[model samples]
Target: MVLLFRNLALLLAILLPQTVQAELVTKYDPVIYDPEVPEIVAIVGTIDARTPLNFSRALEEMPRATEVILASDGGSVLPALTIAREIDRLKLNTTILPDTGCYSACAFLFFAGNERASSGELGVHQISSDSGDLESGQLALSDMMDVLSDYNVPDDVIVDMLRTPPEEMHIYTPEQLATLGIIGTSSSRVAKPTTPTADMSKKDLAAAFVQDFNRLWSLPNAQAVDTLAEKYALTVNYYGKSLTNFAVIEDKRAFAERWPLREYLIEPGSTAINCDELTCRVETIVAWQTSAPERGARSRGRALQSLTLVWNGSGFRISVEDGTVLERQ
Candidate 1:
């Protein structure tokens, strides 16, 4: 009888629902209810097998909610994937509020956000099974990878995930969260003056600046938004329209998602610069190719760009930018 009960207990532990415990707290915009600030549904507590069904019920009760906020240490891996699928199905944004954390299985929920974000802790580690069966653990890992792949998580991040053990977590730093396409959370870049140094001329500054700009622009990273925003003025004559830097960055963010792979080349010998006391005007030809493997889409082009820049004591900021495509494929 003792042996039978002991085996039964072990089996029950293995079969227990793996998920979270938490109430969905809703935050409304106002009595006036602004669509711009969509109502949020907060999920907090232990995650177990029941969380997905609970989430669905909560959504039904709060039909207007468009974002989900998560705070959890972790939960079962499979059910977290189920919740993530539903989040994706509804195109809901996921957030981890400042000071709160979403770790382990919660990372799956965070990434499923149509627009993922977090100011709080977001962490991941290898998936494991309670049964101590290596085969079951391997299957869980495979399933987790498949879900992450569906969400377009970066290959580098996946590598990090694979290497981290179940006992240890890889917590994402704020900059990593932002630059890795996990979040576009506001982060400032401090620009330093290079002109005061006797070793480099203004021409050299401009040349080096162009190289760094092109190199960063070519990366399939989310940091481009911050980098370009740092180099642009509050208002810009961008491509064609007069737009605020904020709007420009938003457009850039969307562009990055649409094309996760890119290559930008400043056509050799095609750059011209004219400078005065506090400003510079530059003209360059750039050839570019961008692709989205998930969507099976590719775009390639060469364009002539004219830019007007103003010195901000530290460096040049683009105030005007005009581009004309010379060729497209």
Candidate 2:
């Protein structure tokens, strides 16, 4: 009887399920885009089972983080939902840059942002179970709908999400995203400058400034540098003398030669702008790297800089710049 009991116990142990360990592969880091602006917390990689704990740790480490930038390929569902709720709870603004990609479960967290903006792709697909069970799939879909509803996502958007298959993706365009209230909303918090421009709204001008600045750093060649320099007034200085005419091209080329491969990483929501009728000031922290790591001479670091832009009748141009570049410790 004892032997039979032991055999039965062994069979039961073999049949019963064991606790599954959380698989976390997400990378969280603090990014200071501008010393004067609030810090941005970056969350990258796959949101797996361990993401919830990882995100919790990040929040605990950077309690002052008021914004979050996400670049993820997606992963497990429950953990993503947990992260989304946490983001909502913290009331952080979330943003995805034009070069970044957020998909599947990552979209959930993006949608949960109190003030969300996406200049890149936000992809979604139906939720499914690994076992391909219809009941489990339905339950998963239902749970997703519940969360989406809680986030106040539109019914049409939720319908489209349901229609998309797990194997395929439905990427939301900027226009569609606007309709979904994900972007294009001007913050009431932005104080209007004493002299606002009539030609372009402050929001549009700010967007243009960010886009142009990004383009300027992507390929810091002679032509790119020249275009950026043209945006600066003739009185703008490089080292000491003004960067005007031939001096502009020469100085830019010299700088480009030193840093053959330059890259600037901007933290989302780190851009702070103050514009008046004639001038605007933009400040941000940038992680600037001016070397090719593959070539064994890479020097990468962060700096805080401020650009003063003046409206030149037709458009805005840089009038002055605080040349101080404080390297990040």
Candidate 3:
């Protein structure tokens, strides 16, 4: 992810001010960490003329990369298409992981995938020109549609993209992708480890994961950095704060020190889990009670938690954690 946002802006200005500006999280280079795609090429930021160069550099360095992961808001569609053809030429799978977003021309990069998957968000809208007449816009739009047809984007999806105004967006979540037959549940789904239905469904697995998270967090040792990092990514969007897993661990440690004793769990029947094959979004209500004898205080409350979890072969790991207090004492 681009932690150096200031540098990213300067880089974009130097590259092409009108077309490329990165509001993305990761990089356009070789990264072999993502569970899928042993050697992964992640293309984020904006797709400018230089995008193809960076992409080529990544592939030249990591020829074994079986997939390209994208999380771009978008940039020039022309350059994006150039990159897409390269991805196709190399026959790379494409994916979008949780907490990331793929939009506008970025959709072309995704559509060109040999095997596509998305656990994040994908958004589309009408083709736009910063300085062009209506006729020009129509011509551009028609050309875009033709190219998307060539890329094998679903007709309905393409229609939705064309219909969305340039200023607005039509967004598709992983669940929507599943409904569109673009994900694991799709008719074109390739072989994957069977999601054990007899033992536990995905929703059930999500609920249990959340419940276990709460159980672990209620412990005095909940702040154990390594333990917390095991469930949550090293980088997390905790509530709204961008925090490292260690920072979050310390935060929990402070809470435990303040409360002394506490119990927390997901409220019964309040779990709502949405999933595709690779990611899950779980929404649930957490009830908590805390006691601080030193202050002679007792507290009870409930909060709604929104969690984004991604599959890592054996189990899920949280990528985003957000909550809203629904009740407090």
Candidate 4:
């Protein structure tokens, strides 16, 4: 009778597949990369529920890290807030590299940095709960606001956050971030060439604008492009294509990465300048060579470009730029 009972229990166990629970799995595990600077620790991954613990372990191992470089898409909000709190306690500087992203709850970690620097994407949106309870959502938002307030984030930034929907994100430009007081103006990540004074002659302004534009292509940075965009409403007509300010900046970034600038020269007799009290326009022909060596017997292609600059009250900035390959020998 005991053996019969044991056999019956085994049969029941075999029949009850639904009694077993599946283990929950996280999408990504946090990892620290080799430091570019001795005091900087680079971390990359999703900020899931386990991230805080993982990050804590990383911090424990690299207790001397004074800065953190982050690239993440974000995940569980509670863990993200916990990680942010840890970052604040450590008083570490935070930076995001160009072409990378720190989105959603990841932005909270960025804001927690004592000194924040972002040359890449920093995106934010409204926080929501999976349960879809209105009260829960409100409580979550309130908690987020408290966190931001504790970090001294400006009121305007909070407003922006509130307005952004959970399904969509707002990507902050360096200039916008500075204006919102989220980042310091003098931060290396957002530094750009100074604009020319209003008193300068249109010719001088045009010359300065050209010089800066060339510098932009030589070493492209989003901050510099954003500065130029803010100073003058940029409109580019390139190779029969029309580009807005953001598009122009993105194109320049892509171009710079693909072919680093070796040398650039503006043709002497190819420049024309016109000005009025409210605005000025400069048109010029420029030439450039890339650092990449030529393939086979062909020389590296040289770009001949036509550019236009417009001046508002602030200073001159690129308004239109068109380019074509002038030489490939």
Candidate 3, residues 1-329, lDDT tens digits: the string is: 22213233332332233553433323443222222233666765667777888788656656777777777878777678788888878878888776677888888888778788887788888877634678766766776766666655655476568678877878776765654545542237522222448777887778777887887667554332224545776677888889887887788777778887888888888988899988899999999999999999999999998999887665677888998999998
Clashes per model (N, Cα, C within 3 A): 10, 3, 2, 1
| Candidate lDDT (C-alpha), each | 0.70, 0.64, 0.70, 0.63
Q: Write the per-residue lDDT of candidate 1 for residues 1-329, one digit (tens) a residue.
A: 11112232322222222342332233321011122233656566556787888788767766787777776777788888898999989988887766667788888988888777766678878877756799988888888878877777755466557779988987775665765556742122212235536787565566656666677777656556555666678899988899999998888888888898988889889998877877777788989999999999999999887888777665667788888999999
> Which of 1 and 2 is ahead in TM-score?
1
Candidate 2 lDDT, tens digit per residue, 1-329? 11112232322222222442322222442121222222555566677777788778766766777777767777888778888889888888877766566788888988788788876778888887645788877777777878886776655456557779888887775544753445633352222122235876764675566556655755736335544544566677544566664566566677777777887767667778887777777787777777754567777777766777777544566666564566743
- List ranges where model 4 is wrong by over 4 Å: 1-28, 35-38, 185-329
lDDT of 2 at 204: 61
Residue 169 displacement in candidate 3 (angstroms): 1.0
| Cα error, candidate 4, residue 115 (Å) | 0.9
lDDT of 4 by residue, 1-329 (tens): 11112232322232223444432112224645332223655546677777788777766666777877767776777778888898899888888765567788888999889889876778888888646899877777777878886787655456557779877887886656764457752243333223455775667767666766665544434444444444335466654678787886676667555554345667777767776665555666666666543422213555555556655444555556666776775
Report RMSD (Å) for each prediction in the order shown: 19.5, 18.3, 14.8, 14.1
Q: What is the TM-score of candidate 3?
A: 0.46
Candidate 3 lDDT score at position 149: 61
Q: Extract clashing residue pairs from model 1.
A: 18-48, 18-49, 19-47, 19-48, 19-49, 20-46, 20-47, 20-48, 21-46, 21-47
Write down the lDDT that model 1 would get.
0.70
TM-score of each: 0.49, 0.45, 0.46, 0.48
